[model samples]
Each structure stands twice: as C-alpha cells, then as structure tokens.
Target: MFGVLVVRLPEGRLGFLRAFSGMLAGRWDVEGYVPPLFDREARASLEPQGEATVKALFARAEAMRASPELLTLRAAHAEQSARHASEIVALRERHEVRRKQRHARRAELTEAASKSSTPEASAHAAELRDSLHALDQESRGDKAERRRLEATHASERSSLEPKLLRLERRLRALDRLRHMVSRAVMRRIHDTYVITNARGERRLLRSLYERAQPPSGAADCAAPKLLAYAQAHGLRPVALAEFWWGAPPPSGGRVTGAYYAACRDKCGPLLPFMLDGLFVARPRTFTPPSTTPGSLSILFEDRWLVVVAKPHGLLSVPGREASLSDSVLTRLKARYPDATGPLLVHRLDLDTSGLLVAALDARTHSALQRQFVHREVHKRYVAWVDGIVTGEQGRIDFPMRVDLDDRPRQIHDPIHGKPAVTEWRVIERRGDRTRVAFFPLTGRTHQLRVHAAHPLGLGAPIVGDRLYGRDGERLMLHAESLTLLHPGTGERVTFDSPVPF
Candidate 1:
C-alpha cells in the first residue's frame, strides 16, 4: 500500500506542515502516517532510499516556506487596521467637542436677541446668520476633502478610514445646527419689529380717541404717564396745556391780584387759573409813551438818513396785519408826513431795543439795502446768557438751519444747511451769567440766539426775548451796540444802547 509518511521534527516548526499534510491527505484520499525523527543525520541518511516519499516531502516543505511571507503580510495588515481604528476614534472625539461648542454659542446668541429692541438688533442678527452660513460652507468643503482622502486610501488598510467617516458625520451635524441657529435669529428680528409696530399703532389710535372726546371735569387727566412713555420711545406728546395767561412776569416783582384782574379782562376766564399759582403773572397791558419827536435820542441824522434808539416792544416797521401796531416806522411816518420817500433800511424784532437806521429816500434805501445784501455792513449785539463763560471771547463756526416744526426757531445743522458764523467774546461775568458781545458774519433769522444757546450751552436766551429767552415775562436781551459805514458819506458810525439786563 502506498502511504504518505509525515516525520515529526523535535521543534514545533512542523505544526503547520502536519496540518497541511492532513488537509492534503483528506483531499487526495491517501492514508498519511507520522514517523518520529531521531536526529538530523538519521533523517538525511533515509533521504536517498525514500526519494519518492522524500521528493513529496520536499514539495510540501517548499509550500511551507511560503508561510513566513504570508505571516509577514498578515502582520502588516493587522497593523494597518489598528492605525485606521485609532484615527476613526480621534475624529469622533473632535466631532463631539465641536458640537458642544456650537450649542453653547447658539444659546448665547438667543439670550442676546431677547434683550435688544432697536433696529441695530436686526442688523446684528443678520450678521450672525451670515457668519454661521460661512462656517457651514467651510464644514461642507472639509467633508468633501475628507471623502476624497478616504477614497484615495480606500485600497490600503488605514486606521484613518473610520475616523474620516465620523468626521463627515460630525460636519453634517454642524451644518444642520448652523441652519437652525440662522432661522432662530431671523425669527427673533421679525418678532421684535411686529411688537414695536403694533405698540406704536395702538398708542396713535388711543391719542386720537382721547382728543376727540369732550372736555369734562378736571380730574388731572393730564397724559403725564403717556408723555413720559412717548418721550422714552422717541415720540412727541400732543396734549399740551393751553394757558391764556400772557408772557412771564418781570424778574423784580411778584404777580399781584390786580394783575390777574387785568389779565381776566384781557385774556378771559382761563387767565386767572393759569396765573393764580405761578410765581409771576402776565405783563400788564400798558400804553406805550407817545413819540414826542425828540423823545428818542437821534444818534445820526441827515436828509437821507435817520438813526435813533428803538425802545423795546416797539416794532421797527408795521406788520401787514394786526398784532403789529405802534411801530417806530409808523411813528416816524406820522411825525414826518411831508418827508417823502421815507423807507425802512433794515428791521429788528419788536422787542430788540437798538439803534435802527431808516432811509429818507429811495436812493439811500437802495444803497443801504445793497450794503446789507452784500454783507458789507457789519452788525453786532450784546447779550446776557444764564451761565458763566470761562473762555475768553471765542468764535462759534457751526452752520445753522431753520427748525421748520418750530417755525422761526433755528437749529445747528452740520449737514444740509446754510453756513452761519458767529464770533463771540465774554465781556463780563456777573454771578452766574455772562455778558457776551456777538458779531454775526452772515445774516440769518435768530442766528445769534440759537448759536449761543445750543452750541455754547448758554442757558439764557436774549434777556427780553419772550419766545427764545427764559420763562420770565422780562426781555433780558438788548441790542446794545451797532456799527456801519454811512451809505452816502462812507463814514464809520457806531452806536451803543443802555444794557437792558
């Protein structure tokens, strides 16, 4: 019987050979027997007599030689697998950390959105959304790059493969989170606008409703609360108390019962109630003194010109309608009825006491008008404001524009306004007030008054100015000085008025 004999070597190196022989035997249906090895020499001595069996053994030995190379390949494969697993674990850890950070940032943004109410809040939300979007795009790009890398390494056993998968999953999660956060921010902005708009509309409706109602008993229904709320929300209040009481009281005297008696007759019933509790009563309606030709001290005079001191409350010229009576021009015309062609060269506010120049003919009027129009004539005024001025006389170059809502009032406009330049110097500081001499380079309505009050922070307006000055009936302001060149003779003339303050 032909038999496959396997010799056992003393070392365990023959274990794989033994297993292979068993497998071959099973396949070929040969009866395989194991023979014990005595020594290396004895094994070699039987090699010639057992050549056929030996040759079969040598073939099996040659197959066994390939096992070491297979084992090395297996070892390399295991090491590559472990490296890939480690990379996957690391990527997963990074993904978890990034997710947590994103969540925290979203919470912070939500909290900030709650406290902001201005339009700026909406702008901020929009910016945040843009930033989140950019991050999402970056994450997507990274994912694509990671996938590309994974594909390149797909054929090789790399530990980084699983980690790349985890990284891609984390990036997708982050993109979703960014989208959600952006949506939430936009929603908050919309909600804020809706709430503010609704509240504003409701307030407007309520105001109209209240104004339409009939006046009832005085329950102190003053909208003080509403006024405060409106002011806080940048709204102007409309329910202002209408007082019939005239201008504020003079600084030296208190309002007596007699003053209210006269006010009641002149202003009707509301006057007494308005003036009763106040520190000062309305000014007594007094008849102005007759202009007895020589009563006003004429500073300069000629056939073509007349310069004289103008008393407070007397108009420079008559107005086109009522509330403008007993003006200086009216008195001058009356006094000089035969003096033909008498014309007003310039005008001053009724309460501005100053040296006013008038032209006696059209020729002089045209000349003076040209001077003023060309700004060739320099004008100056002395005013007393309610604060101590520390600096030496200075110039305020702020531009000005008319306040349209408060007609006749001028306000500083740095942009989109006419250029106004006023030069001022402190003449004297008395108590808490300073007397300032002003030179207005450009002719503007209420130029000096607005510049001093707003830009210079001068508290008091012109002393006797009822509209612009403090809440006293007295006009503290006086046009104390004037300067100009003679329209005909070209001589420089200066006049000074007694300070009214």
Candidate 2:
C-alpha cells in the first residue's frame, strides 16, 4: 500500500538534508548501489530475507514516487506564482501609466493657469515699461524746458527792471494824487455826475442846457432889449401864450394867427411851445395802530410766565414798521394788563407756527435768557423734506453765517462762519418725502433749514421760506418739542407742538 505523510523539518535540517542528498548523488558508490538495486533480482531466491528485501524495495519505490509527485506539485505552484507575478507586474505598469497620465494632466492644468495669468502679468509689465520710458522722456524734456524757462525769466527780469522802477514811482504818485483828490470838492462833483449819469438823467439836462445857451454877446445887448420891447408891444404875450394854449390847439381865429406870426418874427425861431403838464403825486402815509389782536392762544399762564401757541404771520416782537401793527409781545402785554416787564424768552420766525414761551417778570426773564444763551434749553423740531435720506441718523457739523448783504439769508461757511451743529434722524418716509426729527446742537438762525438743504442735500426747503425754498408759501418749520427747567419749581418742563406739515 502506498502512503504519503507531510512532515515539517527543522529550519537547518531541511537544507542539510538537501545538501546530503546532492553529495550522495555525486558519489560513484551511490551510483553503483542504484544499479544493483535495479538488477531485479540477483534472483528472487534468498530466503525470507528475500521477502524482506522485496518489501524494503517496494517501500523505497513508493518513497521515490512520492518525492517526484511532490516535486511536480512544487513546480506547478512555482509556475502559478510566476504567472501571478507577471500579472502583478502588468497591473503595476498600468497603474504607473495612469499615474503618469494623471501627472501629465496636472502639468497641463498648471500650464493653462500660467498661460491664463501671463497676459495680465505681461500687460502690467508693459505698463510699467511704458511708465518708466515716459518718466525718462519727461526727465530729459524737463531739463531743457526748465533751462529755457530760467533763461527767459532772467531776460524778462533784466528787461523789466527799469520799467518796474518807473511804474512803481508812477503808482506811488498816483496813490498820493488819489488821496488828495478823495477829500476835494471836484471829487464830490465828479461823484455827483457819475450818480446822475448812472440814473440816465444827465443826458436830458445836457440837451436842455445846450438849447438854452444864447448866441455869444447877443444875450448881453439888443437881444434882451428886443425881447423886452417885443413883450411891451404884446408881440410876446405877458401871460405866456404857451401856457394858455395847453395841449391840442385852442379854437381861436385871427388873434391866434397874429400871435403866432409876431412870436415867430420877433423871437424869430421862437416856436410856440407845446407844453406837457407835469404834476407830481404824493404817496399817502398812515401810522397803523397796534389794534390787531394776537392770534396765539395762551394755553397756560403763571405769575412768572405765559406759554402760548404762536400763530403763523405774527412777529414775536414789534418790528420797525407801521405795517407790523401788532406782535405777540404787544398783544400779550395788552392781554395781561397788570403784568410788568413782559419779555420774550425765545422767538420763532414770523412764518413759523409753534409753541412759544414768554417771561412775565424780570427775574424769570433773566433766568430764561441765561438758559437760552448758554444752550441749556433743549429744542426739538419736526421737518418734512424732499428725497429719501440714506442714513438712518446723522449729525451735520458744518459752520454757518448770515449773509450781511442779503439780510436773514444764511450760508454754509466752513472757514469764516460760526460753528453750528444739528443731529437728525429719519422718522418716516412717504414716497420721495422724508419726515425727520431734528435736535439743534447750536442755536443759530436758520440752522436746521440750512443744514438740511445744503450738506444733507434734502431738497425740501422749509415750506414758508421763500428765500431758501418755494415762494408764495408758508414756512413749515415746527418747534415740535421743547424742554427746560422751570425757574420757580426747579422741575423739568416740556412742551410740544403738533406737526403742521
């Protein structure tokens, strides 16, 4: 029976065995023994020892057969392993090829990016080169131009020196002459002439005077005597016939004819004058009495002061005019007969309608005056302007000044005006219009209106202000809220007016 067993040899033993087998196979003795074993049989007859030898030989054959089969299996396994290795190599080659392709693609992408950026870089480089070239050209040109200008300037200076000296002397003399003439009567006469000429009346006077001038010495002699002789003889009428003739001719017969003939002959060329009568009309003047009652309704009154709603078109105080017949102060005085020293604590423009505070007594007046002057009294205004304000809240810190020539007109003058400030926030927007809350930091006249119109660029001019806004309308600035400390109670007092816009 053929049997096979798998056994694990020790590490060094397997190699040692393999070497021993090789050495044995190389020996002549082993080769000779192999031939004898194969001689079949130095005959089959050698006792039971022959049977044993047969069994041993059979066992050896089986062992040899098993080794060759194992060798075959090992060789097949090795061949499979080699095929697997080859397949692994091919896969690796494919992987390498894919990796290289990926690398190549990455390189291509990098190159594309570089190319894309190159134009911009090249453009920047070109600009820099042009700028540098321009600078070099400019530098070269500037040197020549500067030298030419310097030479020209030097020549001009040399040529102008003597003329400048002469001009300076003449200017000084002229200045002295001007100073002298400024105080002279001739200068006054010249000024009067300039004034008359500017009025266009001087030409009329010149024409009349030229016509009145007599012919040389004839005025001193026979001309006067002849004019007197003619007057006596009724050749020239004593009543001045020109005056009697009036406008359009009078219906008279031969008398008119004889009068015309005598005047034309004696005063020969003395034409019958057609007189246009001049009558000057005098302007009627009237002193208007302060009879108009104040429109402002007094809501609250105390011993120290009165609080009232100021009506539009009423002045806070009396103005220097007969037309400005009645004002708030005058009406208040008339209303409160017993009150002494009625003083205005603050004032709103004549067109502005809002809450106003008046001082009844001198002590309260001084106190309130101090508060306003020191900017301790807080004022709030509500205004409606044109256009949407971009920011929610903003402060205008521009300075303002009144135009001296145009009275009451305020202008934004940063360099030479008083510091004025206003803080404002938009409350609501209706279409293109915006309602804003204003807090004036400094109380300058027309402060809020100017700031809103000028720097803020909100188009809505204060409604009634014809100077700064639409004309033939009432100003729309409303004193919405006012806060101040009471002089008597030492408590804070507040007043508010409803927005009129």
Candidate 3:
C-alpha cells in the first residue's frame, strides 16, 4: 500500500508525508519516503540472526524425528496413553453395571409409589423417593466422571499423539523449543516497532495486540508509517489517503493508483491506537442502524410454515452472546411455542432486510430445505451499488470462502471456496449510485455482497457495505422477494418485502 498524509509543518509550511508498506529492495529507509516504525539497527541485526536460529531448530527437529532416542521416548508416551484408555474402559464398564442396578431400583420405587394406598405404605413410598434422589445423584456423579476421563483422553491425544502416536515426545519437545526461540525473536522484533499516537503516548507493536501476536507486516503498512512520521516531526496531519501502486498479491485483486481504505485485517486495530487524540473526523466511528424495531413483521402464516419480514440490522437468529438475544427466530419461537424442528428454513445476513420463510413442523422444514438444496427456491435481492453498471443483466459465478483473518468478510477463492452463482439486472441509474436487483441461484454466506463488490463481478461495491465498501447508514441490500413451493399444498408461492432504503 502507498499512503500520503497531507500535513502543516511547525513553521507554517505545507508538506505531505509519504510511505510504502514493508521494505523496498531489502531496505527500510528510502531517500524520499518515510522510514519504518522500528529501531533500524536492532531490526536489521535481529531478523537475520533470529531467522537462522529458528531454521536450525527446524532442521534439528527433522533429524531427531527418526532418531533412536526419539523412538524410545515415543514408545513410552504410547504406553501411557494405552494405560489411560484401559483404565477408562474398566471404569465405564463398572458404571454401566451400576447404571443397570440403578434402573432396577428406580423401577421398584416407582411401582411401590403407584401401588401404595395405606398410611404406612405412603411413609415407605416417601423413604423410597429419597432413595431415588440418591440414585439421581449417583447418575450425575457417573456422568461427571465420564466427562473428566474423556477430557483427559482427548488432552493426551492432542498433546502427546493422535494419528502420529507412534512418533511422539521428542518431536514435540523440539517443536516447542523452536516456538520458544521464534516467539522470543518476535517479541524483540515487536519491541523495535515503537509508535506514538497523537496523544504523545508511545507503544510497542506487541502492546496493540493484547491476546494475539501481531500478524505478519503489522506496523509495516503505509498508513501506520505515514502517521508515525507526521507525529515525530511536529507536523499536524490535515488529510490522509492510501492507494495501491503495484502488482496485486495472490490473495485478492487490486489496481494501481486506486484509492483504497486502510486494510481491515492489518490496519484496523492499529489505526485506533495511532489516531488517539487526533481530530479524526471518520476515525472509524460507529454508525449504528437508524432504527431498531421491537418486533418482526409477519408476511405469511400457515399450519406448517410462517414467513417474516426481516428488518435490516436485525439478526435472522439469536446470536451466541447474551447481548444479542433479540432476533426473528426468537420472536418466532415465542409466537409458535409448539413449533417443531428447526423453525428457520433459511437465514438472511444480519444487514439484509428481507422475507424469510420458516417451518412450523419437522416434515415441512425438511421438504423446504430439500427444495433449497436442489436450487428450486428462487430469491431476489435489491441493492444500491457504488458505481454505474454498463450491462443490463449478467451472471456472476465464482467460489468464495470466509476470509479467516477478517471474519464475516468473504473473498473469492476458487480452490477452497464453495461455488456461488448470482444473476443481476440493472433497475435504474441514480447518478453515482446504481440500483440493481440480484437473483442468487446458490446460497453462500455473503454471496450477494461479495458478488456485487468483487472486481470480476460488478467491480463496484454496494453503496453502504461496510465490510466490502464504505460505511453508510446501513447496508443498502434488501431481500426483495422469495419464491418456493409450499410443503403443505405442493403449490408455488412467492413472498415480497418492502424495500426500506
């Protein structure tokens, strides 16, 4: 990435700081651009020595893997795992026998309680109920014990061996040593990456990432370098922008000189730390959805199925966190307390407002799910995109997968991604923004958003897509319509939701 920060010098002179990410031709300092955010000498010396040591450790480990001493150590580990397995098996068998006895005891108590009528018999039944409670405790204890044993077994497999049980111990030891050396080097390398926020508070690159080691090329981004230079030289930053001016990397597409946002994966966490105390107008401010409804809009309801209008910013289902408990699925469950199976037949993205269908019965859920799997269910989505589309209609076919580093954001990956297909038609031209309709034939997470933003697809991101494009009021994509066959009647039905944006 190439970055420029327009700055006002302390002497009232106008100038701009420029930087490029990472080293250029094995050098951090270029005559014209700003230097890297690191102690130059320390970084220069440490990298080479540390890398050599780590490589040596790997080579040693490889040689040790087939050594005689390593074999003996591996065998010892195997024996311990085997011993643990046998002990657990024996304990399980004993628990099984006790379980059978407990079952017989419960049966006896139940029968006695049912038959008792006299006062003396009733007292005896009460005593037997106490015994049943004790048995319940025993059952719970057995389950707990089983859980502990299973956990230990799993740990042994993970730490000692799993599929490679026959070649263990020494290999792990060597690997651990290599990790220790690498981490120590990384920590020292991290220390040299000294950066100061606008507040004049300096921090190491490692401090910014609390729970994680900084990803490769963390503080080496053009934006971070430019900001650091501006702060050190008593220059007040007026404006900042980054652009690409090189061949695109293998991971994603890029164009030379196209204005780009600071990378989410690399620069996202760092910018917050660097921009402290600056008059950052857009300093990644939170622009929450304009409205949050107290309830869902039901479009259709039958004995076997129900359809809902999912508002943008409302989750299709409740999230794992307690704070995210409100959702269409939760409301649906409350509305249909006796509903069976997984109520949702399909789900929409949290930012997508649309019509979603759900089943009230297991058979209906299965039938509807099968239709979706077979590509029989048709979906239409409408979105306001960032650029003018030349063609009226076209098909976008690509494979996509979640960008693991930056979650929820997907990238095109034909090798590892699931196949996604979307057909689109231009609805109208709205100056800089174009309103378009999308018909996705396959359901992949973020199918419409990625398809709309990808270079090979529209080459224009949806206007309000925060992940793939710039942030706006909310995502402009809406699930405009859905068509599917009714499981109850075996007849076609289509549902439409009002486009709020």
Candidate 4:
C-alpha cells in the first residue's frame, strides 16, 4: 500500500497561479464572465423585492389617504354637492318656464290692443302690463335666489376642499418619505458589500461606488453579486464575462453572445478592485493614422459650409483616447487652417459611414444647428436587414431610452424614452437579406437601427449590426443623403453618398 500526500496550497501562491491564467485570457476577454441568474425562482424573487416594497408603501399611502374620518368627510361633501346641483337645476328650469309663459301672454295683449283703438282694449292692455311688471319683479327675485344658492355651494366646496387638500398633502409626504427610505436602503446595499481586485485585494463596497450619479440598476447588477458569491465560496476569480440573454432590449444594441466592456460609471471603479489580485492584461493600443486621412471625402464645399462623406471605422471627431485622436474634424481643420469656430456641425456614429455637414464659421454653425433643432434638416439612410420585408413601406414610432445595464445600449421605454420615428421602404431583396431605405423623421440616437430591429417596429435587425444583429465584417448602415438650407445663400442643398454594403 502507498501513502497518499494531501496538500493545501498557500493563498498567495494560489492567487498568483490564478492571476497568471487570468492574464493569459484577458487579451480576448472584454466582457464580464459573471454567471447569469439561471434559476427562475431566484430571478423572479430577487427582482420583485424592491418593486414590491415600494408598492406596499404606495398601498399604505392610499390607506392613509382614505382613512375612516377622511372617507366619511368626502362622502358627506359629495352628497351635499349633488344635492345642491340638483336644486339649482330644478330652480332654473321652473323660472325659465314661468318667464316664457309671461312673455307669451304679454305679446298677445299688446297685439290685441294694437289692432283695436277702443278705450276698453287699451285699458285691458294696461292691466296686462301691470301683470308683466310683477312677472319681471319675480324674475329678479329668481336671479337673486340663484346667486344666493351659488354662494352656498361655493362655501360648501371651499370647506371640504381644505380637508381634502390636507389629506392629499399628507399622502404626498408619505410617498416622498417612502422614496427616501428606498434610496437609503439601496445605497446601504451598494455600500456594505466587498469586491476583490485582480491582485486579490479586497476593498470596502463603497470604495467602488464612485460616479456623478450611481449607474442605472447599480444595485441589481450581476457582477457584484457574482464576485460576492466567489468570495463566499473558496473559488478563484479568473475571468469575468457578462452577456445579455432573452429578447433584446429597446435600443437594439444588445445582442446574444456579444461581449461588452464594463460600463465606466457603473463598473469602472468596481472592476479595478475586483481584478486587483489577477494579472489583468491591457487592451491592445490602436495606432493613429500617418497618411492624409483619405477616408474623409469632401462631397460639397462653399465659403461658409462644407459637407463630407465619412467612411466606416473613422471617427467624426477625435475620441477620448489619444490613439483615436485623429478624425474627420481634425483632418478637415488641418486642411483648412483658416477655418474659424467649431467646424463639425453634426456627428455620425463611427460604425456608420455617411454624409456629414460642417460649418466654416461661427455664424454659419449657429444657423445650421438651428435648422437641426427646428427639424428643418432632412437625413436619409440605407441599410440591409437580416430578414425579408413583407410590407413595401411602413413607419415606426418607438420611444427610446438609454439602457440602465448597458450604457451604450438603448431600450424601448415609452414612459421615459424620447420620441423616435422612422419611415422605411424596401428597395431590394437579395436572398434572405432585404435592402431598405430609411427616412428618419426624428434624429434620436440609433433611431433607424432600433426601428429596424425592435420587435414592435420592423422585427428585422440590420445585417452586420453587431449590437442589434449577428456580428459580421461591418455594420451595413450608411447615411445616404443629407438635405439642409444653406446658411449663406439661403438655398436648399442636398448631399448624396453611394451606399456601401
């Protein structure tokens, strides 16, 4: 028989080995590898907890608003108001009938007197006039009585309104208090937990909670929960990946299996601490271009304004990273050194190749921007979608908002979303893909892309759209044309770019 040796490795040594493995995987690992909430019961129970708490508070507020005493008071007020309204209606109806009767009698008497000049007829007419005068006095009394009744009704409503208002204010205060408590609870949850860095250093939860405002759904994210689980279990943290599963969210940027970097505001500080012990590899640096930016093709140019055709993969302007500092704006500025003011008037997504206009001077820029703000400028795009279109043409009206989980991604949110509209026409169908022309009525971010992909909209994701569709060589979307009034000549000018598939 052979004796077996059992060994428990030191924490430092184990951490080092894990770090080395993490570093090796880090080059291609852009997304968080947190395990998804696969348990239905767990996800269902966890998500509704906060919502249920808030709803319970709201129910309590409703109860307070409808307290026994308040309910009684409201019921009494409603009864009195109904009674007063009915009385007023009856009184007016009676007075109107009487007045009409008197007027008819007076008219008959006057006509009889006019036909006959006899003293007897005149005397009868005078007697009728006396009766008419009495009727007039009665009508005046009715008016005064109506006025008194109105005053009484007003006084009653005034008395009841204050009590109702007091109750309403109390309910509102309770709501505010409930919201405050909820926020405090959320903050505590975000602050009490701990996150371990790649280097295996654990830090307080609040240290990683830095942001101008907490990122959307910060308390409910899976990354923190996954890390907490790893720490609790004796598991080594190696690589992190988080992907969106289920139906794509509103903005259509999220696709299944697509890797996304951690959000700057939400996961920026937290990821650093979480990856502390691991040997995290740096992202490959993108080299700036040395050649004359040939991708920026000038479409139209004048003394005050210029329009340029921007190719895919080139930024409209310099990005935050120094490597991405070279862009269309930079190249144009370099070419026209004498151009004044901010040259680029508008922007296009780096992934979308399109026509963009710029102003050479400040005044022209202001005028051109005004046109955009007033919706005088027109923009059109062409794209190939993943599915065939059954309809020849249609319109999409979907409201959009930034996704709380993913910053760059947008979701359909009718309540909080800005209005976005797009009109689309099928141009051609090549096998499974359909080429479409898009007319954007409202220039919301990702308006055309979302409109094409959203289930409620077109239900066809753009071909080569990594965010909304399957990953491909490129995003098959192009800004085909732009039409705007020239600020200097006061003439409408249209710029066109050939669609590049």
Candidate No. with top TM-score: 4
Candidate 4 stretches greater than 4 Å from native? 1-157, 173-221, 225-229, 250-252, 263-272, 283-294, 401-405
lDDT by residue (tens digit), candidate 3, 360-400: 99999999999999999999999999999879999999898
lDDT: which is higher, 1 or 2? 2
- Which has the better TM-score: candidate 2, or candidate 4? 4
Candidate 2 segments whose C-alpha is farther than 4 A from its true place: 1-294, 456-459
TM-score result, candidate 4: 0.63
The residue-by-residue lDDT of candidate 4 on 256-369, one tens digit each, is: 555565555666666666656656678645443343334688888889988889887788889888878878899889988999999988888767888989899999999999
Give the Å error, residue 57, model 4. 4.8
The residue-by-residue lDDT of candidate 1 on 262-341, one tens digit each, is 11111232222222322343444534334322245577678878887877667677766565566888877876675656
What are the clashing pairs of model 3?
Answer: none
For model 1, the superposed segments whose C-alpha errors exceed 4 Å read 1-296, 338-342, 456-460
lDDT of 2 by residue, 1-501 (tens): 001111123332221000011123343123221111111232233324534544555555456445654456445555655665675566557656655665565566545555665648766556555655665565556456556655664564465455445544554565555445433422222222110111122221112223433222111122222222232222321222111121111111111111111222222322111111212134344332233433687766778878888876778888787677578888888887777665778887776668788888889988988888888889898877655777788888777787643456677666778988888888998887788888987888878777776633343454445555443345667888888888888889998777767
Local distance difference test, per candidate? Answer: 0.53, 0.53, 0.85, 0.72
Worst 10 residues of 2 by lDDT: 14-23
Per candidate, the number of residue pairs that clash is 14, 2, 0, 23
lDDT comparing candidate 4 with the true structure: 0.72
Find the 10 residues in a row with the least total lDDT in model 1: 251-260
- What's model 3's overall lDDT? 0.85
